[model samples]
Target: MPDPTPPGPRAAILPAPVFTDPRVTLFHGDAVELLRLLPGASVDALVSDPPYGLSFNGQAWDDAAGFRESIPHVDTTAMSAPEVFEVWCTEWAAGALRALKPGAHVAAFGGARTWHRMVRGLENAGFEIRDQIAWLHTTGMPKSMDLSHAIDKHHGVQRTDRIVQTSEHDGVLGATRTVLSKGTPVTEDAARWEGWGTALRPAFEPIIIARKPLAGSIVGNVLSHGVGGLNIDGGRFADDRWPTNVALDPGQADALDMLTGTWQEGSMSRRFPIFRFEHKPAARERPRAYGVSHTTVKPLALMRWLVTLVAPVGGVVLEPFAGSGTTVEAAAGAGYQVIAIEKNADYLPLIRSRMEQ
Candidate 1:
């Protein structure tokens, strides 16, 4: 085999002003190196949405001689998919477990393709798989498909008030866009018209919640609750029916608002601002022009939900691949100590700006 490669440098070695802050320790360097510096079992929770190993945004390799004049020296493409993922999961899981207090939990976010691999890596790092929770979102981008138009009239004239039946297409296409009014039809066509529905939008992804098992004996079977589904005791005969897919109505919004401590518009008005920020689009103009480091950045709502679940009230949370500091912001919002490590220096300022705001 070739000579073993040297490990990346730790992010903790940066200026004192960077890592000294306990509230939010934002390290602008390689996570693998930074994680090595942290004491084992030092965190209350290890929550991160690592790169999917797909080399998203093409940051895996550098083509500096091409259109782009310069590139970040650190290229992740040197390692194979399995090697990269294994290193990522193992390093963080080991450090996280070492950092956590006994019986603490870790919720890692990953795509379907590498979710199992991550779970396996965590298991190897000595973490027990607890529950695989689905972090479902209420909003997503639209998908396009080719719709075969059945021309009912051969007169080459568009029929007035004619029904255009469209089935789901795999490819993107611009057609009669869907629009929906409140309490209107929930059909595919209606959803299309209203720009609602995953068929027309991007598919919702799930988050895996795996816990580091407590050392003691079984404590009467731990009880757990599902956010979107039914309630039951540990020994009850529960049928695994498909989870009830309830849209966020006024009542659900009110309940969630209370749970998440969202500010109410008014005492009488039941509407909560939880979804308001959740649904807010990216800034029309970015603060600075930087190449896309990662696509499908995790929303703050999803990160906050995970942080609240796995981390203790004031415990430290570690994100190995702290892209854009979504986890950092969420952890700060939830009042937990956070240490975010990102290798890309260009995104460091962006993360700082967002967190400082």
Candidate 2:
């Protein structure tokens, strides 16, 4: 049997500062190692997108390295296996829990396939499980392999190499070329799953909202430590609608009809209207000038709202898995003091450029 202990610090924990300012601080190293140096009960809120144990990045899958849109900069080393990844998460959560004040909230992003393991790990680390917020989007690409296509290729059915779809004119074809799929079809020996897909179309990502157990009642806790309440009014939607757990992808609002004022909830529903929103694209000049942003980078609008939802005005925020410093950018833009740490040094320059811009 494998030993069930979390790994110790990967390197020596240092107190030296990487980059520091009045509004923002940046660190490039192992998150758990860096987190161990911070004092307990220091940060007001925690928001981050940690490794979900899915080996989707370049280093894990050799067939997917160096793609233009793939995570060329991120080489995920913490996710060797699910159990090991869970231990990694638990270690960081323990550090984050110690760093957070009592009654503070944490909003963490997790992948759909590994969300259950992440939640269990966090709960074990002393966080009270509150809710799972889903961010829905329509931009997911399905990577399921077509079984029928593979079966045909196995039966000596060679796919069309290259062909010109152009019409022959005067017994001569044009000098241009256009290729089309040409493969044998599986008929009598077709399996039941021949036409069926292996996976569902991707849609939403789950964000777990959790909190540290308070030392006292809600009001008492807030009065004592200035933490423990959600900023509902400050983060509400327009037309008197309360904040909801659902958010939409960019340009998704146009497809929605005008929501009426008369929203009657069921007995089990929260007694207010739920609302969703679309994030407008950031100004083109910034991304164009700096090159495309991080592949999994959260939109600025969504990050801004999420930071405000948990962290109080002028409160200090901590993001341990800070990829490209999106959370740091959001915090600084919202006038909150933030500390951002990323394991990948490749993204440090990009974060600096984006934050400075």
Candidate 3:
């Protein structure tokens, strides 16, 4: 046979883009518009946490009470709960799914209430619901006991708020008693008091990992009980086990201990270290008061781990809703070519600044 032609530069795997003077191209408009301009099958992975339609507005709530107080200020009365979810999953997610490569994974972070609808929408869009990973955060509000009280109370008009207050009071009393009994330093022991009781439980958000079938081939049985199935790693079914079930309490002690040491700058040796960096109060601080601008910002370490798991070295990673550019920065750090798209013009500068640094 004649000598094989050398692979062209475009065909050759590109080197990982460096963070210093990185080429982070920003689209300062709607993501749907940006995604439409990009070539299909160009990305190796897709990761994003889209708007939950909850309209959190990024204000810091002191407690469940504070959150409740802020509700009147929000326009939640316009649409029913289910309607809001359908709009996000069906409308917004439709745009997101179209942006992914075949066999590529789209990890979307969402609350429990909307996860099922999201899965159903993804399945309808010809994507396989692979794994439902739990992203347990350290900051979360307590659960509400209103439903239980509503069931128990014979009054036609059930006062759910009263029950929640009672539960909160009990939790505080229990914590005070424990502190007195143990004589432990209040500052050190105070965290124990905020345990996940009926009223106040840690928030459990789910990260749905869905995959698009490769083009021109029959979609494999994604529900198969095998290595690449929905329960690939032996976790419970995605439908049954919602991410909200996982508590947002402090990470395991081992994980916390790993985060205590200072991270070495520009050292790839500590890639995907098991430590939980966002747990640190300083790291969680936000510059703006409204909507945190990026409240559900995924930790850089977490994004790095996910990027490495899904994309090979020098593979392209795409984040359609690149809020604050966490996915882009992490992808660059892990030796992956990144393409980030953000709708908010205000955040373009912030994203560019982070990537350059």
Model number with the top TM-score: 2
lDDT of each: 0.54, 0.69, 0.52
Residue 336 lDDT in candidate 3: 73
Q: Tell me model 2's lDDT, rounded to 2 decimals.
A: 0.69
Prediction-by-prediction clash tally: 17, 0, 8
The digit string of per-residue lDDT tens for model 2 on 1-357 reads 998998886755555556777888888776766777777898999988776666654343112121111322334454345655565667678888988999999999888988887888788889998888888766565656666656655675644542337545421112333335434454444344456556777777899999999988999999998999899987786555677787766333323322533333331123222344333334431232234244466666677778898998999999987776778888898999998887666667767776767
Between 1 and 2, whose lDDT is larger? 2
TM-score for candidate 1, residues paired by index: 0.57
Estimate, for each residue in 1-357, the C-alpha lDDT of model 1 and write its tens digit.
976978877545433325435478876655545666676556667788775554443554211221011113335456565555655566557656665555667767765556776787788777878777654444554544322111222223333443444445422112233423133333444434442323444334546666666645334212221111112221121142222222232344555667878746552132323322243224421223254333446667656756765665676888877766778877887788887777666667666766667
Residue pairs with backbone overlap in model 3: 57-291, 58-291, 58-292, 142-200, 142-201, 143-200, 143-201, 204-244
What residue runs in model 3 are displaced by over 4 Å at the alpha carbon?
1-23, 58-81, 143-199, 215-281, 284-293
lDDT, candidate 2, at 338: 91
Better of 1 and 2 by TM-score: 2
